[model samples]
Target chain A: MSDEIAILGAGMHPWGKWGHNFVQYGVAAAREALADAGVPWQDIKFVSGGATIRCGYPGFVAGATFAQALGWQGAEVNTSYAACASGSQALAAARNKILSGECDVALVVGADTTPKGFLAPAGGYRPEDPDWVRFYLGITNPTYFALYARRRIDLYGDTLEDFAAVKVKNSLVGSKNPRARYRKCFTAEDVAASAMVADPLRLMDICATSDGGAALIVSSLEYARKLGKPNAPRVAAISTVTPTFASGVLEMPDIATDSAAASGVEAHAYRSMIPLKAYEEAGIGPEDISLAEVYDLSTALELDWIEDLQLAPRGESAGLLRAGDTALGGKIPVNVSGGLACFGEAVPAQALSQICELTWQLRGEAGDRQVEGAQVGITANQGLFGHGSSVIVKK
Target chain B: MSAKPLAPAIEGWHTMQVKPHLIGSQCTECGTYFFPKQNDYCRNPHCNSTNFREVELSRTGKVWSYTNACYKPPAPFVAADPFVPYAIAGVQLETEQMVILGQVIEGLTVDDLKVGMPMELVLEALHETDDDIKVTWKWQPLTQ
Candidate 1:
């Protein structure tokens, strides 16, 4: 349908700690996307970029920062910060602009150069801030991840092996992805041997924070047709939804979940709502999705997201994995781009990177890891402070 | 020579007494409870009740899940010098059915806890400055 916004180009600056500024990575990805689209920088009518809080002032003004870096052609600029979901929010903004005819073609970019060691709160002692409060209470990100992982094991009968298998499967695919940060394939033994960061989650079970970037050039279908590329992959739906009140799910940066006793919980919890909303908007269901990419901040989270994506019945993701249903050639191959398991997390850039991989797979350009006859794909991610996003794309 | 007196890291969290209980807010109309006290308004989407009453949470709850920090968390989180790993748990209160996260009592590890185990709330020192001791709530397995 004409409702789709065409993804004319997708690009990334390899995922790793290069010790360079975030702008350099963003600019490199943007130039590659521009080149791939055969659309000159001056032709871009709008730009939406994700903000990285760690980069000081420039990170906050990412849209203008990237536009100026690419040689300001006077493009309209917008910046978004939804934590890890910032990239999806940026893409959603660009898609809306294209659909509304405010811009025929728009550039979307997200990049981050994370700090070394565990992610720390920005300087300041604001006791009222939940992020700071959690940190002060010794509630690290991995601590929360482990809480959920352990819950899955208790509730779903999932085992340590099931969690390790995810690392093994994703790392194998990551080994083939030159852009991924950790290329070496890992065995379950290797994952087990890694030091435990959080109980039930070993070092390898969690994704590392790294420096990387991803960019996309999107346009209206009519604009794509005018450019002589009629069959480009198009984003059918983008869901950037906040949690319903009294969300029972415990998310990051929050010390307690919303009280379900007051509002009465919805059928879908916070995490499940993102992709379900996208599916409804796309006029499709789980059965229609050819493949999926989801936020795998931890190995157990990947399995949890699989159920949230409705690819498997609740609490049965481990069964799906054991049966080889989520492998490369299995039903609904997930994280074919190696996910955060391999690429690590570049915060703002990570979600957009998922879309980049989907764009290539939908266009039949993914060489070794290509899902044969792939048509529809979905990307799901959740950011701290109640931001959840999902995007559906089709060829 | 005496050590400094202990204080709640953030005030109004709990009472410092023989039996310490977490102080929170309950929506008088909807009957939903919020820990860390939502003093402003009720979070219930279904009801627009601005009226809330402060209530002390149940002393005991079931463990929803638990984990331990094997590495020292970065700043803003004040860990002991020569950091020691600590355990954290999500305990679902008996009445509220809402899960609240807190550090487990000293010397307790993930191995000592299990999902659905009964736990009681207690006050523990989070860290200490030269002049004052910062205290926060912790979860402890109820002794039989």
Candidate 2:
């Protein structure tokens, strides 16, 4: 209804390790979105940027950095940082401004340039910082992922083959996506042959860090109608909720989980709670989702996200994977953009990229990898420090 | 390196004595616990008690989930020069009802551990410094 913001355009700079400044990728993606929307750059009133802390102080003020890079037009600027959910938070800010009638049209953008090898924390004896503590305890990012993957084997009876199949499935479609990186199709044997980074997770099973950017052009329904494009896809909901106190599982960079020992405090899975608000705000359910794009930081995580999104019953995503139900042309096609499997992760940009993929799918323009009759698409992603995000985009 | 005395890597995190238990704080009102010492505030959404007491955690717990680090981690980890991989576990303490992560004691692999198995806390050398042998808490799997 009136609460929703129209997605007039979506664009992305191909995901890869190009070794360029992150600003270039953001500018390129922004220009592409501007061109795609047929909206003049000068017409945009607000620029909401998702931030990547790795890029230094400029990255912290990314909205102004990108605005100045695009030549300032006195447009208002804002920056949001929620780890991987940064993009959704930025989009939510833009949506709020639009709904509040402070501005009719806004640009939502995110970009990143990641370092090579494992992401480690700053040095010194800083027990107060969780990142430093986890690293000191020798817990890297993949360790958490491997823990979840191991649970699939120990509890869900999922095999290493099931985990490898997820990589195989996503890699096949990623090969066809021009915007994706690491386009080579991977085999189960390839995954098996890859060196184990963590038990049950090989090098190929975990996504790499990359430099890429994604952006969106959104406007009020009235602005779209005035532009003679009334049928643009709309963002019905954007949920960026935090975990209830006493998180059930140990999340990234945390050595211990919140204790559920206190009376009346229940430990809950944070991932499952993310999508519930999106479904409520969108007035839709998991059954209504025709497709999904999720954070697959690890191959097994895709399965966990599928269940978390309620796309499948708990511990049953492997069946969907085995039955080819999560691939292109399946009943509920997932990650038609090949997920983080192909894209690795550009952090801030990756979340908005999920939205860009859904926008393309809903507009019936995703050539080769398009899900047929994709009327409703939802996205789920999680990051460190209790960042949980889900968004619904519908025709 | 000169011979040096042994010390807790970060002071007050745990006891240095043999069979050491992790040192944490508990909310005086709600019974919620925190590791790495949290004496400031209670995190229970239901309880906002500002009062907390220092407490020793249960020495033994059950394995909630486990994994290994096949590659050496970056700075602050202080991996050996040759880099030996180590298995890590998330153990659910009986009293805390919370899972804590730590390295499985030396000479063990993921193949040697299973979920829900009992484990006890122990002190091990995290790394050796010129002035001290830095020790941290580790989890030792109990025989089934």
Candidate 3:
């Protein structure tokens, strides 16, 4: 296990439609994390924050904004924006600082209050922007999710019933998570009865837009040992990779995929590379992961992530789910914190929340949803504009 | 006013013809193709050649996958007054070995689409204002 940088504490503001400022949620989560770590705000040497674009000026300079809100003590600050992977990028920035001895203690926070309905592109008419072009062509995120879902159905013989099962499973575990937005267990019937936001994807199959925050406190292992926390869980590795040349799969916001005519495609799908890089950096394989938290914007996507993470062989995620291997008590339980299905997506906060869940699981502090004897965990997600991230944490 | 001279929602994207085709860029050195036309450099990491030529993509392809929007998308996606959900398809062009996404023709729905079915490109109205009708390329499954 790598002990380069220790995760001293992890915390989050309960996710819901709380209708508060993003800064307020971020500050609350930050305070909770600092208290949990037993670190004074003034002791933190640096702060790295994830930006939420919808908010005005403060959103752009979130690191300084959060530091000011927490009463700045002249801590060095930085901010990162990678859409859904923003939090992971922020954590990566903090981890690098701690490991390099540039900062003894670092705080990483991400928070967002997502606007309701389809996430629109930043207001503009720049014809050069692919996001604007896709929007004008009426391609929403769910539409892309549906295309993938339909392809899976045709290629792998997956059924709508199988997709509903994912929601049912995640909701059951989500109901046990007090911080999750949706606390009620959903049956397959409930999922089937929900309205279809995009064909082949029902309301329950898709996660909601929510408001929330998540934060983490990290320090060098030496500092962690000096602080009387000799056994703190540590961030083993973080992967923030972009797509390979001529990536064959169609990703979000882009109307087309890279051409495969020149650089012939790889045997594995593009998304799988994200976690593979993390596994390499951690010197661990898929078999070493006891649990995982993956981006599940839609039910079909959870299955896609399963294959991408190599939890199961290609085209076998549905079989794994049907066999109960991905449930709370099964081999390699995924998304024990209810996932996006229950928490909804708070954008910048979502990826950090995944890390928090993994931290809790590794430390054996997850009350009801704990994966027994969990030692190593991984969090995997993709962001708009070709950003992909995966983080590995170990107890 | 001559039906407002139907204009493409974005220029340099598709040809204004009865049977429309997407315009893409081809790397002269590596033979790679790019939609929405990459002019900066050859995207193939192995090839650093910057030379490119504009080419019209194949008008016919096969459906890689398809889905329909059941809810009205948010702006700047223009929708009909009553907001009729529309089907979209990802078509794998036979020549370039790339998949491009576009809305299906007006009469087609998700029910009419199946993977690997042959499809052809056509031009259709995306949305209209009092003065002009914005057009975009769409996919239509060819009758077997």
Query: Which candidate's TM-score is highest?
Result: 2
Interface RMSD of 1: 1.6
Q: Give candidate 1's error at residue B87 in angstroms.
A: 1.5
Model 1 chain A lowest lDDT segment of ten: A261-270
Q: Model 3 clash pairs? A: none
- Measured against the true two-chain complex, the DockQ scores of the candidates, in the order shown, are 0.74, 0.85, 0.78
Judge candidate 3 at residue B125 and give its lDDT.
90
Best by DockQ: 2
Estimate the lDDT of model 1.
Answer: 0.90
Summarize candidate 1's per-residue lDDT along B45-73 as a digit string, tens digits. 67778888999989888898999988888
For model 3, how does the per-residue alpha-carbon lDDT over A1-395 read when each residue is reduced to its tens digit? 44358989988999999888999999999999999899999999999999999988999999999999999799999999998999999999998887777889999999998776667776767778888888888888888889989988999999999999999999999999999999999999999999987789998898889999999999998889999998998888899888776677788888988888874554334478789889998989999999999999999999999999999998999999999999999998989999999999999998999999998898899999999999999999879755679999998
Candidate 3 residue B51 Cα shift, in angstroms, is 2.3
| Alpha-carbon RMSD to native, per candidate | 1.6, 1.2, 1.7
What candidate 2 keeps of the native contacts, as a fraction, is 0.87
Best by lDDT: 2
CAPRI accuracy category, model 3: medium
Error of 3 at A382 (Å): 1.4
